[model samples]
Target: MKKTKILILSAMLVSTLFSCQKLVEIKETDLIAGDVALKTITNNEQGIIGAYAAMNVEMGILLNAVFADEVVTADFYNAATVHEWQYTSTDISIRDSYTAFNLYYRIIDRVNRVLAALPTATAANATDEAKRSRLRGEALFLRAFCHFELYRYYSNSAVGTDLAMAYMETPSLQPQARITVAPYFQKLKADLAAAKPLLPTDFSGTNVYRATQAAASALQARTALYLKEWNDAVTFSTEYINAVPLASRANFPGIWTDANSSETAFKLSRTASLGGRIGSLWRATSASASNIGGITWTISQKLWNMYDQANDIRFSSYAKDEPLLVGSGRKYTRLITKYAGTAYGTAAENVADAKVFRTAEMYLIRAEARAENNDLVGAAADLNALRAARINGYTPVVLASKDAAISAIMDERFKELAYEGHRFWDLKRRNLPVVRITADLPQVNAATTLPAGNFRFLLPIPNAEIQANPVIQQNPGYTN
Candidate 1:
């Protein structure tokens, strides 16, 4: 007789419904037995795909922008609280935080279940074994990726200090205590190390949506950068860069519209039927209808001035100038069209594929790592390569010191990876101050500058998590 038991893992409500473009849907009733459900190659594939779908949501993307200085709200709402830096533990947008926490963990739970089941699951042939190995690697990658995201938000350390987060490895109902920052990173690295050899150099299909060997390396580089492992960061980033070359200036604009660009290492595929509201948050209903999205998060002029508008392709491709009435019938021109939604040639559809990783990021990572390691010349070369690709008639920047090179890399990251969610974390990781230019918008409070060591930089652990798990501790600033 087959043994069956119901497992409740934390606060996550594990539903059996699974669907993706490449993977077949798995129904709840069909997956009654855990062993039977994940007993086949197809079932395991669907399980991992479902985890990817859950991980690729809009809440984290929106929050990353709102909480940072990348964009500001034009209208009043609970999201505006995050924009103005006035959010608390009980704020409505805090629900978004809870959603992110739960979503990532849900991914972890799914991945763990798949990994556990894969050993016992029947594989008919060598092809099946290969698929099983790739799937296992993908699951491990997802597990590490999700945990890293959670660590960035929940953990307090800029460096790997003794900060703790609930590190769940197994699919169990037992309450888990938070692990320290170093141990959490060790686990993340271990997972990535195991995954690297198992994943393929390229995915089977035309879509680069799934995690590949390059994706694993890119993520490892990013993790290394966060951990201050400069040499390791450079090595992994270089490996990824060698595999995936940067998109030329002509092809850069197409990457956003076209899903199958060479520069995109890993991105979540979004269709009209199953899409996100990221475009709606950043884009207006029409070019003329400013602030129509309810929360019109316009780009700051400070960020706008950073680009060489005439020479740089990114400026034209990423930003749009629109007129906004500031005060007393005065017209103020603002850059409001960074993300003009997913209908490339047609009207805006308010839908876009969530960009997780790209080759350009690898270049930036390598450049930063080189700079950190005092290899300023090497850093400048890497930076110039990206600049030469993006900018017309590009002049290579010559830096006198390591500081100047580091600063240039930071600026490049801000311009290149603006809305894709790197700004806030970049500032946090470097211990740099978040100085918002509120003079442009008088509606913003005077206290706009968030110092490097401010407690508010670390988001509060969601109230739900706190209430559910007594072992979990809230971040220093937030009160339960």
Candidate 2:
């Protein structure tokens, strides 16, 4: 099937708050926009590389800007104390998030343009058919991957009977601006399925740095689980995990710190010239030249204490020392240290790939699915494999029942996937209680529940999208 360009309005048209760096720029005159560089076959390869590069520029600031403060409110914001009914009305986060949404759409636009151009380009003719197919598959997988992330945040919860947020399929040029949740998942699933067969089993000769079949499988599993397709979740996740071995315990830390690695399924590539890096931008202390100055977020003391011992390698990997500005107020004895480097300082700006999907996540999914399916023994074994790998001096999992096993799985996911965008979704998906907190406000009761139709869970449809595409309605709660 022919792919449609899904460009939204130009970033220039959006509110001024999100004007960080252009998410997708394709000026032929400037090599960075990925136009002239990707005009030919060899250049097309570079263009693909550049497309992945855009993710770093788009996500680096946004991740720290939105996630650091929003996800772990209990750590810094006293989220547990504030009532969800009373979050900041003028939250800078709203504006920051709007900008991120704009940037991500732009990134998707570029990937679409590349996918569109690839078929007719000279590069398409010169490369072997298999190589070409692999490259195209990587692009599809990536496009689907980004769209999925967009859906999760922009749309409402898909729990019980509620459908997810509307999916954005058409590029900005098309008049059909929004599609419903059912169709959105349909399109995302199709893209993932199409990409699956074309992708290589493992990275080899070419497309090594791009998404492979395993990556696509991993993505399929993720999307499936989000839609609550337990069996499909088990199948695809198993496929992904079986194909790509998990990162050895010793090298786990390196996956977060560096750009290049065999274990990484798909990452946004960064370089000194491109102006993006996860580690340096997220730096806690000024000791590093590339440090972004202030550390915006720190690992929660609660999480830090959860580690079984002082000697666990995973704990040390994420622990860093930095001064903090807020709640339980004190300097962080150890900030999240997984991202450590000056390769992409705030100014020098090296680009790095955002690690989207990895093998470890698959294990977590399998554990969750099995527990949900009432296979307690199967679930415990999967969870234990990872726990043993990350924590030394581990004891065997002891839960004998399914409910106990499931709780263990959630806690394991919290620790394993910490800081990796899963926490917020997990909380929302399970329909857990969310209490917004504050340093200055009155304490909210811990037992306050997230109402069934709470609007905050869904981001108001981006204001810019509403203005440009009149058909795009605001999500249930936010003011247009």
Candidate 3:
């Protein structure tokens, strides 16, 4: 089967704010109006693909790593303002936050347009009907997924009962009000529920880039785990695990390079010509001088020490002990190979597919849920299952208590899902502290730790967003 051709609209077209901006302003110079673009099944399909393409950018993935303890600046660049936690609403990083906020909302708008057009979209036959339903399901999934991303970055503590993020169900020029955390999650889960039946059990024609029933289940499992719905997390995660098995130790390394891994539930299909420099941001590459992959950031020694380097396949698969040259020819021996671009079969050094969801995460989710529910034995088994697959000469850990089980699960999650954009959010959702040690590294600050309840963990809402939408209040501890 042919790869799904990326059909993204122009950035200016998709980047328009939902409030006080006419939707008609999204039209291109030669293309038809936005409304006409979604009138047919083919057009709606393109629009849905565009929504997926919106997530294909790099900032969201990189910001998560930057905020976490996984990386430190490589001395070639200064991100100290954001990296050292001295950021506010007006910082340059905040501009990237604004762009991410708008990007996800743009995805929501595109999905909403397709959903609105679906009922009356021109379908030629029963095959077209099937296509329409699948498209609708994918759109709904994208809408939920985008909203969840926004909530993770911009919202206050998930445990708090306050306005968090907006749930955009329809396209409108009216200022969208931020809903409270409870209701926002309600809407998020509803979208996934509605989408589940419409999607196929698995993607057809090798299309794991698109949403499948397994993908929806895995996302719902993640959502439930975040919400502390232990039973629901267990149910959905089990459903996903039953459908997709873990990649074996030998096959696991290939998953990073070979985009189409059996372990991946969903990933954003990226080509050298289409995607952003994701791999470059994390790894050092020889592709281009501009693609000095780890010039801005490299893996932290703290994270590197988490694995038993001799026995853990993840240590070898995700990291490299190559010499990193700094000013005056001073060289360091730690680099993160997780996002290196060599795997994408592209000449661009930093080009690699963005992994969205993997079956490995489902096992971790299930383990956490079971541990929370006091099923230590079951949780340990789940954790051991994942470890056995990723670690060489693995030993099945036996946890005798709930706390032990939870800690093991957390450690496994850190090792298993390190650079794939889960570390920071995992720390936040679990209410764990963000601690950075300056030991063995001069690039980072000396022993800075942000407690679990600190206000900075929730990013400051961009000042531009606050200015544009009066109804949207800034996150506390941030000034407009």
Candidate 4:
């Protein structure tokens, strides 16, 4: 372990330094300091709670908003640099990402602090060994999860190619710290492996809110696929699926709206008026009206028509009719109502706990890995199982070949996991050529296709970080 300095002021220390919103402050006196001022270790339960607290401000909100549909509105061009034609590595999107990144890293730092303090924690009987192990596992899984997501979106990593983005190892307390991509994933993989055995089987015990062993398995499955570990991907995903009670078709959509359902692998359980609400930003509004953040977001027409086919459940899950407000005369396509029944104001009043990892994804991951491994029969069975649960009368798919099985799994992934921030990555992972349909009608507008090497795939490093940290290298094809 590195000997770093630890500063335990009020969390007001962070707010004073960062000028972020008025979030709840973790009491400072409770933290225990070791010899190195750079690190603080605490055996308190609050340390574990603090690890979970890092999810919102640090990463989820910004990543979901930007990656979900992208900033296509005309106003986006003016409000944010990522949308502007003059794209740079040091743009605000990249900069904003630093704060988010720091959030996760901060959690990781705290986890490490707790680990360093573990010897003393154990001696004093301040923590139960089993409970301590479970908490440690949760922290490891979260650290790996956040880093993996950052690698995919920000770093340049092509599907099935060796030229993906570098991964970060330690969360640098300093503003800008550099970590390479390969080593980063290695650390994540190692962390996840360590945590897998220690984590509890029932993470969502009463609230489906925390990470469990199943979540660790699901995450391992995702990371394996990203690293091209096909067999490992299948293994972990299979383990996760085996643990979950498969959902019936009629209960599919409820997985998103009704958090109480068994289908949710892990969720951020935010009761009404409790946590961050994404619905407020996504609710239907007029084209002419400014977006909630002075930037209006609409569902992509191309994404909409993908569901127009018969028996496509996503058509309902991802879309709605746009009246100027809620009930104006003019009609257009609004994003599918993932957050349903709850009004935006009510939803936004409290943060809806973010659903970070779910079981539905493991099924798709298994299907993809099985197809890639030339197990077409196995792949088809998995694909059909997920479909049978969604489509009222889905006919089982018969695969004569691997390619056909792959196609079926991809389609199922599109339907089952659409708008959950997985499609863009799924397409990227498959190395599929993406054609952005920018035409006004959306079904067919501008057929802008980027080859597999298009630089757009690599998110520009947060510009501010690049400027602040000289060691942090800009991803290839983007400017510093």
> TM-score winner among the candidates?
3
| lDDT string, candidate 4, 148-233, tens digits | 76676665352333433334444345544445556667777898999888877775565367777888888889888877789999
Alpha carbon lDDT of each predicted model: 0.76, 0.61, 0.78, 0.60
Candidate 2 per-residue lDDT, tens place, 1-480, comes to 123222234444464435533434433443554345445555555656666656633343334223322323323443321223443323444554334466566667766766765675564454544456666776777788778877776663454334444445444565345566777788889989898888777654335457888788888888877777888889998987777677766887776666346355665555556544454444433534433344445555556666665546677666644434234344343455555543323433322445677777898888888888887778888888888778877787766887788678777766776656675566667665443334322234433345544666555665666677776666665565
On lDDT, the candidate that comes out on top is: 3
lDDT leaderboard ranking: 3, 1, 2, 4
Q: Count the backbone clashes (under 3 Å) in each candidate.
A: 0, 25, 0, 27
Clashing pairs in 1: none
lDDT of 3 by residue, 1-480 (tens): 133333333434456554326665555678776668777888889998888877744666676677778786664655666666678888986685434677888889989989999999988778887899899899999999988888878763556487779899999978777888888898999999999999988653457888999999988998898888999999999998998899888788877776447678788777767645567675445544433443556778888889988988889878886533434342444667776666323476666677788888999999999999998888988988888887788888889888888888888888888878788778888889888776634354344777887777778877778888888888888887
- True-structure Cα RMSD, model 3: 10.8
**Model 4 deviation from native, Cα RMSD in Å:** 9.8
Q: When superposed on Cα atoms, how far off is each prediction in RMSD?
A: 9.0, 10.9, 10.8, 9.8
Deviation (Å) of 128 in candidate 4: 2.9
Candidate 1 per-residue lDDT over residues 1-480, each given as its tens digit: 122233443213343322252246445664467688798888898998898888754665666677767775554344556665666767777766434677788889999999999887788788888799989899999999999888777763645566757777889877677778888888888999999899888843644788889889999999988888899999999998888889888888777665346677788876656655457666544443343333356676678788999999998877766434444241334544544555333444565667788888999999999998899889999999999999999998887799899899999999998888778778888888888775534364446777897776777777887888887777778888
- Ranked by TM-score, the better of candidates 2 and 3 is 3
